[model samples]
Target: MIVAQRHRPSSSISDDFETQGEKSFLRFLTCGSVDDGKSTLIGRLLYDSSHIFDDQLAALERDSARHGTIDGDFDFALLLDGLEAEREQGITIDVAYRFFDTEKRKFIVADTPGHEEYTRNMATGASTADLAVLLVDARRGVLSQTRRHSIIASLLGIRHVILAVNKIDLVGYDERTFDEIASHYREFAKNLDFITAVPIPISARFGDNVIHRSTNMPWYQGPTVLEHLENVPVDDAYIDSPFRFPVQYVSRTDRDFRGLAGQVASGKIAVGEPVVVANSGKLSRVREIVSMDGPLEEAREGQAVTLVLDDQLDVSRGNILAAPDAPPQVGDQFQAHIIWFDHEPLIPGRSYILRTECDSVTASVTNLKHTIDIHNFSQIAANTLAMNEFGVCTFGLQSPIAFDPFRSNRVTGNFILIDRYTNATVGAGMIDFALRRARNIHWQALDVSKSSRADLMNQKPAVIWLTGLSGSGKSTIANTLERVLHASGRHTILLDGDNVRHGLNRDLGFTNADRVENIRRIAEVAKLMVDAGLIVIVSVISPFRSERQLARELMGSGEFVEVFVDTPLEECVRRDPKGLYKRALAGDIRNFTGVDSPYEAPETPELRLQTIEAQPEALAMRIQEYVERRT
Candidate 1:
């Protein structure tokens, strides 16, 4: 065994120490593969730092006897895995945050899960963290999850990392073992852009090299985990960056007082500083900086203050205030990295609600560039992103918004994608940069408007969309409806699903991605036809409800009519007019609606045509009457 080094005096490190209230704050997270002892390491830190209370310790001892996994010893993991499901399963399911303080620093540590299914939970914890504690089991060194967490940490802008090789006692505290794991990890992490990747051998269960140096590994000479954490530099670069204030709310006390209330996202603002609205380019000057305690001379990064402008501009919630000389990029198109969280795969061309710090707008992923392969860190071609998958995509917004690149400012660069129908958060994204085309393209004014064109044609513009399963009578009814409307001297056009495939959508296939593109193309065409003052009829087997909703949003309110052809699957299969169903069932065709593929019926449609209840001519006449009344 190697001899232990002589004890050094505490004065050698006195310059790095600070008093309690004056200590700097650090936010960090612990993450790794399942059963890698993330929760245990955090629990040890709290216990050794004298942050635990007697009552809490008593409760912990009692709980440890029942649910502990350490052969009746104190289970440090019990302190953080609080949920009953987590305790019973001996795993972390949600992100658990705990706050503690040392003499030199204050800390808010997030204990994240290690399971593959809960990777999204890990990302949530990493978002606000400045550093990451990546724990790895000594026996299972450098697993795939280790690479995945490192990639996520890098993307989230964390520059510092601690590679805690836990369970060192199980490997006999061997120096060779620790060196091999540390060297291998450093080789893999060199490309991740981490400024510091310090490897420390620790046994969270035994508390070795955690808060105190380990006697078992005399060959290792490094600062304990707590020592390194207390001395690491905290990133405060936002203070030097350009000013950014996202207007959260407009505070109005009386007719003469209108103050914009928000936290300064970056830089500083003073009473006389000139500011501009980022999206609108309206100029203004800060008249007064109002805080809760009354007027203040200035406010810097992270301070929440209200600013009274010298001029009355049209600024409101969702407008960003910035220094006139360094305004953020304003555009409607961008390239971003997205981590999908929902079970449903992300479909391109489907509209979602994109929510930023203070703005929400309709947005869609126009193209998926590639998905990262966690095992090899390689980019693979993909059309969609599934749950727990990360991809680089191009996003198109309905309206322009101001933003900075995520590397420049995390607060102004991050956004979440919400499902338009369910309001559930489906994906999290980071803006890279605004696309050049979005800034170059401009909408030119036209003398002829939709209303003017409609008046000239003597009718209201509309798009009637018919959706149903394959082999249904949608095309037949559409043909009959157009004939009835045309005979009445109404300008109309019919766009059938099969006819368009031969010309407009000739490059498409039967995959889900191709189907989405097919519906998108048809919707755009129908909208153009409606703008030209024609009653456009679209007949297609639009299987997905999301794509149908996308089509509806492209038109004006109440101008898009959804007609669901409610035909029984059995009836449609028997009628198989084009023999498509026969081929699908015999394995000659795939992705056939109502067979291998799913057809989501509309929950609420404008018109429900029961084909079995009436003939095609009669149903078409009913549709014509409804259109006449609606128009």
Candidate 2:
């Protein structure tokens, strides 16, 4: 029988772990299919290593009897599955992080959930892990989720992996079972760019070969899990790579003490070393490296220090300071691997907030290259990515950002896509490389600007966007509004939805993804019309609020006026002039807004025209009056 090791004083452990000396530390996560014993393995490690306190052990014993899955025995998984729901369901949900140390090295282990629904949480755990401990059930050789987690780990830059073949005792500790499973996994992980894939057979429930050698598996002659974890070389090569420092804050503690405050993401920086602001390409020299302890001569990777510059350059937050000769790439377009996390499919042309280390910008997936098939690792053509789907796509940003390829620098290349309206993280992406068009294309300077064109036309250029359910009198109101503006000597253009679709968007469909692209194209044309000094009127269903918000952002402040033609769905069905409502109701049409698809009504439209409240002409006059007042 295996016995728990003796415990060390908590104070000494804390001091040893927190000390910033030359001790090596490793960050790893355990992941696999559900019920593969990730939590049990972590708990066993914590328990057998004597990291559990007396109160915690006692609580585990009491809680095991209440929520135990091991027939009232000591359920090791109870230690890590802290959530009540997790305990009741006997599953891991959120990533549970725990820290422990042996005499050899300190470790931070993340026990990630194995459920397919929580793959995003697993990805989050892998994002910061240097090594991955992928668990697999002995009965099942390699599952789809196993391949998926492995791919995600590779994408997140984790090169070292330990294939822990768990539950060997359940399969009678057969050497053939272990060998076949390990062989299959190694073959599957061949293309993942893993530097090392070590396979170890262990029964986490019995604590066999977890912290000590197992007599039950005498045929398996290999180092135990703890031995491998303690001996594996921690990769610290980022310190030797190119220097990169993303300025998080500009310290202006009085004018005499101006400094750029941020952590050095990679490489070493010494005083008097020439650095360049990546986006602006302005050159300066590092005057001082100030740390909390005092001024330092040099700072390496992972060091938080304030850098005082020799020159008063135009630098601020969200700017990258890099070595003068090896500055990062600055571009507005790039190709990246995206792991979509939102329930709503990732729609191209729909804008999202792209947040990197210290920078935020409006970005959209311009094109979806293809999605990876987890079952066979094949590339399949797809226009949109669903939840937990992996795809390669081209992204277009509103402004240029400085970044390196993820392969060379994970810190600078990683970013997350946030839903602009909900402020929820929808996707995680890693930059592969910048697109050639980003470097080739440049905006030409024109002496005559939008203001000059509007002044010449003697009118304030704007886009009057009319959105509502289909069959709602949006087109009629837009036509009347444009007519009135034209009669008032305002240069005006009307872009009816059907008219534009007949030409500009002829190839587009009514799917959610297509609708996003349709609106994006119309918004761009409307922006161009406004730039030409014309008042552009757009009449479309424009269903999704996110797409409408995207249109609003493309225009100048107050230049995009949303006019909601508030017509009831019953009224829209009653006035089904185009026979669309009939077809949609009869199941002949799909993805029709107000029928099958969703139409997110404007929350705070500039003008809400209730068809029941007034006639079309009167509503048109109301919009005209509003625009005139704004002018």
Candidate 3:
């Protein structure tokens, strides 16, 4: 008979010799705040389970003596956190993945970073994990970082959560403290959609309730962490939820053969089953499912194989193949929860490349509804989302795409926003659902034409936007220009900012987020007037370039003219006709564009007027003359 080691690894982690053939695999993650002992817990698991070799143990002891965090005892963290920087800082900086096996199962545990700034890295680890082991310091109880990580794990669709209350020894192994923390976490989790959350108190340093049950905790009668890992059910329900295959590659071996190659994102595929092209609604039956060995009769979710269709249908990367009868919802608009990751704040109305699987299209955030407060989980109205911020917003795609609600099908609903110029992934979004109106409302073909409307008025239908500082004479010049147009028998309307605010936009404030929405609403109104074949002159201090460009896109090509009324800051301050600048300079006004907030100048404008150098009447004449030449 073989002698069991002094450290009896749980039955789940029985020795390699006593193990049976073909163990199943479990992929999990360990996450929490820095110094919460995530890496140490993994190292303890590896050491106590006998996964560490004799040589590795000796090396760990030697390193522990020189720079161990806990006196001269063996520092298990040194084993998992392999980076030199991690050793020096005594914190896990990057995600460290380790593979180990026991009698019942194999395991892949990701030890992710815990700092708030490295949230994106944590998100990456959560994406592939079937279970998330959330570590919390027993002495500290619940924390904001812990809540944020839990929210992320839930958002990524990980239904199983293991709340590992680490370092119980430091808290005197008190059962009351453990229960209190667990209760707090449970109350917070009520808002989250995760299915199950199990709390277990453990001393990762002493191997208590990890691979072995602890003698100190006589009151507790739960399975060890190792035992829980062995029993936790891996959800394979996605395989039966719905069939969704994003075409990633086109395998054309020769003229005789062509295959649509991609991993089965969800559900199963079998020969003779009908599949629909999500983008084009083209239907075709599956002819063959081929693997490396040969043709297979069927393939399930997570399998990589080549699919041969019965008919010669047009299908390429970025196209989604789905069940013919239960098609994904198709639309050009969505309400989504997005996490911003780029250094630059997400600019509303700025065009980005929205990529889902292989499909990439021009897209933009049409509206920023509100942002989530991680500390208390409250919704705060926002104009833009900064790095690591989560916000609810509306998205507009250049073209319609097929998708399911993210809660129902992650493969078909999750997308990333890539910068058009740099191609950097700036944001990750999960679709709540397609906008109701986007699916229900269809554009009605109008009988009256834009050309006919303009002809009836006998003039050009244009939108001349006046943009500059507060006291830059934009309104004065616009008034003069409208008078000149009226004298010349042209139809015109002057939408002065102050006049509109008294009625249309009285509810809006001067916050950056509010400012973006202010411009968005005005742009829509301008588009409507331009369609009516009237010369619409808009005078406002539109500060941001992205919002200005959005207004341009709303109008026809060459119909929107941006007039930059350039005035020196000194000149504007001296001529603070409304005393607004005086209050702004005195710190009474907040989010005042030039005084406090940011102002992105137009890189190139249709017309430029230096108000400080010339009279308003002269500038108005110049603008009128330019319009006449263009029309």
Candidate 4:
């Protein structure tokens, strides 16, 4: 065995450690797929680095003899995973953390789970890690799960990655095998956000190139894993970033002393610098920065302090103090990426509580753009999100929130979705950016509101959307309903599909994308008419449930109703008034509903009437009666 080196110069590790007997700390994590030797590598690091006590080593040797993965030898994985279940199953379920010190530096390591079902646990560990040590099994090369964890590590803003090809002995320590695996990973990592990547060949089981250099691989000459870990630079980019302080609590112990207590999230704040309360746009000057020991002249990021302002203001929890010259974006709409955690699927139009940096707001996911395929980072169209799924979505908040992009500031950009009824955290999100329209278009204050206009007209404004198959008597019923509504002294307007197609939607075709656009235009027009205090009736074959739901969400609650005319396809074909159904059936036209294309019926409609059983006049009166009750 090689003896320990006589001197480990602190200068080789960092220039800052030149004057210190005690060293700075490094936080890192070990992550990869199952059976990739994450726990074993960390255990080996602790053992060979001389950080373990004699008693602990004795117990580890005894345990290894009793229960080892390999026959008649010590098992290092048992050191980190000490639970009975983990020893029995030989798989990690929860994150394991350990703290150790070396001659050059002090370190804390988090050993994360490798199973696909425990990705959230891995994410939780990676959130606070400054570096990631990604392991790969030499026998299996690279797997899909390996790429998945790498993508997540990049998304969490980890800049430095050390790719460790563990179990190199199993592959005969072949130099060609290591080079091929490293090349494949480097090529695939081109699109990721990592700053630097270094590959190291090590055998965790036999301690080859782990704590000391290995002789088996004579073709490779590089620093060992421990040597690399001791010298990698810790990210200090947040020091130059703009200052941000999110107030956590108000410390008002006495009438004369009131201060905001929180940690400085970014940059540096001086005692006399001007700061702005981001939520209310109020300005103030920093009077004092008080720590537990005494007052400080300035505070940098990560220092907890009680800030006293120059003027007395109504400050409370969830308020943010930021640099006046460059404040964070404040808006109610944002484009974000979310990782769903709950078993129940996400409802696009339902309300949930979104919490970020001690602030909570009522929020709804207004639109789902797509779900990502983690294998290749491809986008697939989706209407809902399920458990363990990643999606790109847009959210509408009840009030404005202050934040930066997640890539810039994780403290201000990350949020969690809480189930309103169960109080469970159901999803996690990272803000990509604030929607530009939400920032530019401010709500213009008006003296006359929609309610005031409706009051003057002596009726409630609403949209009665009539949808069904083609030639289902939707227009006939709409005509009768308009006549009935007008004779009752109510102002109304009918927006038929043919009239809309002739002018506004004339450019659209019968394709799915065109249908979505057609419904979007109609919804916007109907919203404007409702604002004018008119009862708008829309008659069309809006087949897609997603578009219909979009129209409902565009209006205020209870201001829109869906009425389905349930006429069988056979009956509609027999009474083909427009002859479009015959052409659709004969394959003369493509994307024809009920023939080639599919129609997603409404799960719950306000009214479903069998048009064959009753005349158009009777059905129209039935709708009128329901409208009168609702109004």
Regions more than 4 Å wrong, model 2: 1-15, 18-21, 438-440
Model 4 agreement with the true structure over 1-631: per-residue lDDT tens digits: 2222222233343433354575867889999999999999998898777556556666777777776686665588988888778888888888999877777787889999898878788887887788899999988877887887888788777888999999999999999999999998998887888887788999998899988899999988977888888898885658888999999999987999999999998998999999999988999999999999899999999899999999887788988899999899888899998888787667675567899987999887878899988767889998678877788999999888898899999888888898765687888889999986646666789899998899888999999999988888999999999999999988899999889999999998877666766887898899999998999999989887766876887788898989998888888889999998999889888988777877777779999989987999999999999999987
List per-prediction Cα lDDT, in the order shown: 0.90, 0.92, 0.86, 0.85
lDDT of 3 by residue, 213-316 (tens): 99999988988899999888876757877798989999999998999999998899899999999889999999999999899999998899999999989999
Please provide, for model 2 over 214-287, each residue's C-alpha lDDT reduced to its tens digit, 9 standing for 90 to 100. 99988988889999999888878599998999999999889699999999999999998999999999998999
lDDT score of residue 114 within candidate 3: 88
Q: Which ten residues in a row have the lowest lDDT in candidate 4?
A: 1-10
Which tens-of-lDDT digit does each residue in 1-631 have in candidate 1? 1111222233533333344556789999999999999999998898777666656677678888888887657687999999999999989999999988877888999999998888889989999998999999999899988998998898888999999999999999989989999999998998887999999999998889999999999998988899999988996769999999999999999988999999999999999999999999999999999998999999999999999999999999999999999999998999999988898889888889999999999998999999998766689999889988889999999999999999999999999999887788898999999997846567899999999998988888899899998777999999999999999988999999999999999999988888988999999999999989899999999998888998998899888999999999999999999999999999899988889988999999999999886899999998898888976
Best candidate according to TM-score: 2
> What are the TM-scores, per candidate, against the unseen true structure?
0.93, 0.95, 0.79, 0.69
What is the lDDT, from 0 to 100, of the residue 351 in candidate 2? Answer: 95
**What TM value does model 3 have?**
0.79
* Model 2: residue 203 alpha-carbon error in angstroms: 1.4
- Model 1: C-alpha RMSD to truth? 4.8
How many backbone clashes can be found in candidate 2? 0
